[model samples]
Target chain A: MGMKLDEALVRARRALDKPAEFGPDLNVSEFAVVTGGNELALSRGRDRLSLVGVDLSDENRAGSYYQVDESVVGISAKMPGLTVLPFEHAIEEGIIENYVWELVPPDLDKYTALNAIYGRRGYVVVAERKRKIREPVQACLFMSSPGGIQVPHNVIIAEEGSELSVYTGCTIMPEVVGLHVGVTEIYVKHGAKVNFVMIHAWNEDAHVRPRTAVLVEEGGTYVEHYINMAPVASLQARPRVTLAGREAKAHLSSVIVAKGRSLMDFGGLIRLEGEETRGEIVSRVIAKDFARTTSRLRLEANGIGCRGHTECNGLMLSKRAQILTIPELLSSVSDAELTHEAAVGKLKEEEIYYLTARGIKRKEAISMLVRGFMNVRIEGLPSKLRRQIDLAIAMAAAGL
Target chain B: MRMTALYVRNLFVRSSGEKMILKNVSLELYSGERVLLLGPNGSGKSSLIQTIMGNPKYEVVSGEIYLNSERITDLPTEDRVSRGLGVIFQMSPVIRGISLRDLLVKVSKRSGVSLEDVRAVADELNATHLLDRSLNQGFSGGEMKKAELLLLFAQNPKIALIDEIDSGVDVDSLNSVGKVFQRLFSDENRTLLIVTHTGHIARYVGVNTAYVMINGRIVCKGDPKRILETIFKEGFNKCLECVGVGDEAR
Candidate 1:
């Protein structure tokens, strides 16, 4: 029997009957439309319904450069009427639990929606989907509210034996007030694989609180490389992962360049829960011109036959720049193999002399080595992403 | 007199929290001269070479080192390289995260040479195949030496301080390396100061002058034939106690 619109609306309402202090204004029954014409209306309707029209837009998102238009559409069970979420949702008696959404957009604004959701006390707003998407998802998080506060929630789930790549970035409007707090939780299911690249080049004053947590199932692998080349003064991020399955693995790589009195804190963790799990975490931080940076790593292996390696290295270019590295490894399994290394200092004068003896200038030599150190992790990235990251690094290092 | 390749006077070096490695030592090398420094393990031969190259690890207590009449003991290593100072280290060179081709290209560009010229030099040093790989990474012993030689040739330094050029090299590598040295010394104004204890290197590199160092001081100086003959028969112990006059009287 064909259901009536009233019945469908009632079903949707019942689906969203969960406890919400202040919802995004869902008083009317909106249809989950994918068409271009209806998508703008839907966006506008969402803004109006949520009383967020004063700051948000309703433009339809275009596909990523690598993907054709209208590739795929995702709808969330909680926001079933909105039509696009990142994970799969199953409706229970009156609410949806264990919901994982994947939002792969062609442009950058999807990141903005994510920020809006989390910025305004939106709960469990995961910005990414779990499925292995062939097309690239482009997202942009632009802070145009002028001192507006935002805390975005994003969860990434890679199912068993699946593969996915994500590219996300953030941009802040000038004189924008408030804070940008982002939390991301990643799950790599058994034998699954996920690669995440996040580019943080926000405005200088933007305070970003970015946190990521990942779980790896048996035989699954998760690789996350973050490039924090922004000139932002106050930025702190921690991307953590738990190897929960046998033979599960995770690698967290990051490169941070802080300059000009900026205070940056970079930290991450890798935990092995199952037997034979492997995890590697590497980080590089360069501070110059009175900047202060701290890079830390925490590795915990509980299961037998687990392996973990963590390294945190820092380079201080100026006399005023201060850098600290804290590397730790905790293992309960007798068979677990763990190693941690930390080093912080200026370039060895002998090394500079050696380079100069080859006719290289002192400044040029130091710049080359320091910049090269920052790009070492890019060697393992995909070609296109790696190139973009390299460009970004050069720009940041040049202080441009 | 024409400008010599290198000159040192009143050289003194001391290790950190340790005794002096070299005290008031003096040496000089004219253009195109192949010089050898023979010594026991504790001698300051390596220290002298690094000091001349301006290694920051070694502070010049009281000495004046000149390269072509220009004092450069205070300059950075890259500046020394610019002034025609090439070195073949005893151990591996630090590997940078760039392609060998780019490294060679960088050296060539700074040296005012064409890219093809760099390529030709790389080919001459048998490092052509390694140029596409990362700079000095995962290279075998022979290959690393060859790459070092290519870099040296690209720099085209007037003075070369070679530390144990024959160590860790097998017979086959010894011959190839010997031929390169022969070519390197063929041109005047490109001097070399080789440091080694083993006399087998004599068959590979033809030396014009030789000096034996013991206990941070040069004990004797002589022609290559006499030094090799003496070192082969008596070793560093008996030679340390002998004066340059004769082997018999104390």
Candidate 2:
């Protein structure tokens, strides 16, 4: 079960030379498959994780999953009616038989194909039927091996009438050159709810590609929040979610920070497919230094009485930095409502004057504004996790 | 001799667009004195206060400004603020991220006002709900004036330039704001330059001198009660006896 050479391997081989439709292409052969980690992961990994606001020792979390390179280092679940396990372990135990790549396919892209073949190290989270776990579950992936490739396939399932919350942080050690391709699929069954928060931090030498898809059934709610604050060489992610059942709802909020020569292309798409379903995609981006970002969010309404909205806002901090915001909305039914709004510009001078006139230094005023622009105020997050995210946003704003 | 807390002499001001907004304006605000600069719309009364506060939007093309006898014509807005200059713009722009509490703390740096002290002032002003919110974000007209007053209180400046503070405020809010003005006037160290078009604030706040501007020039200055009586009788009319003809405000 280590590696597959069947149709999965064939798909990986055929799409090995394929390039992503969005973001800069990464050379697949440029990185070595990380096979092991040195003593630093055993000794100082927690310290490095803490730098990005990842806390495993917090008792408020229902469970925690830690993965370094290609290995799953730690996994646990503290509450009943909840299951958290590594991808391989969950596969062996048959917990992800229906959720594994059911929403996201291998042929979607070269990265997904590679993930289906070499990405056996990730997390699996499942909430049993009618079980609403109050505490948030934590998952983290660490890419520390230099010039290495770390592929992870993550699956989350909230069974019928169940509720689950997860916070996933992907980070790397200082100055480590790595390529991380992560694939995730989330399933929200009837009357279930899922809150997923994924934050990534990396040095300037890393390139990341994350592929995710979510499906929300009838009377279910799916909320996703994504943030990438560290200076990465490049990051390209466009996760799509479908509201598949009547009265299903999905809200996707993304915070993107591009600095220090980083190139970030991030977007989200929400599809309202069922009657009376609703969806929204909101994104905020801060581009500084020589960084450049293209932020796009799209919403589609296909069923009667369904409505969707998409908004993309970007702030440019430097003359050399560039930001592009694209908002797309589509409605196939006459009764469906679709709207979009996009704005990409620098910090308003009136806002700066408002603070500077308050006796605050101009630089500090700009920093405060930058931090506020990055604040999305995600909904339905636990207090402990929300505090961690707030701290992380503050630290990221200060880093500039 | 009385100390001039804020002295502006022959100040010709222009906006960032190079349009002249203030022409040959001169005023003297003595310590412990609250003055009302009254005018109608487009009369440049707010421009005078903004020029004194060193808003980069309005540039002093010539002449000089002094605060507490120190030349501050060339200082930036932050420096002027640190020198005990406080102002509440007629319409404070929505600051997306900076909270009122954060701005209060930053502005109160020289005044040594702690966060608790700011909180206390917010409570007194009935603006505690705005303490944690982003400055001026989604605030009603009344809430905007109240929040600006809270910020001014946090600074506790020696000179306060309040523009149209009573315009959008309700009667209750005006009472609270008037109380804050009274507190400032109770001390001998504060100079007040309250700018208004309606001049209705005179009923709530006390002012020593009332200066009426027909266009960009101060045409008349006298006892607050007399000026009010004259203006209320005739409206913002041309007082050519004390001043000459002038152009419309920029």
Find the candidate with the highest TM-score and give its number: 2
Compose the digit string of candidate 1's lDDT tens values, residues A1-400.
1232234334334434332111122211121211122233333333222221111222222122110011112222222111123311212121223422222111112222333233222122222234444322333343444454444445555566666555555555444443565556566777877777777665666666665667778888888777777566577666778888899888888888887767887888887888999888888888888888878788998999999988888888789988888788898878999998777777766556555766778887777677666765533455655655676677666652
Task: Please write out the lDDT profile of model 2 over residues B143-234, one tens digit for every residue.
Answer: 89888888887788878898998898888888887776566457766778888877766666567887877668777777777767666776
Point to the candidate with the largest lDDT. 2
DockQ of all predictions against the true structure, Cα-based: 0.48, 0.71
lDDT of 1 at A197: 70
Chain B TM-score, candidates in order: 0.87, 0.90
The 10-residue segment with the lowest total lDDT in model 2 chain A: A1-10
Candidate 1 C-alpha lDDT tens digits along B41-144: 76888888888877777778888988888898787677677678888776645544556676677777776767886676566666678987765678887777
Tens digit of lDDT per residue, candidate 2, span A276-307?
99888889898889999987788888878998
Off by over 4 Å in 2: A1-13, A38-42, A56-59, B108-110, B114-117, B120-126, B179-185, B241-250
Error of 2 at B119 (Å): 3.8
Please give the CA lDDT of all the candidate structures. Answer: 0.63, 0.83
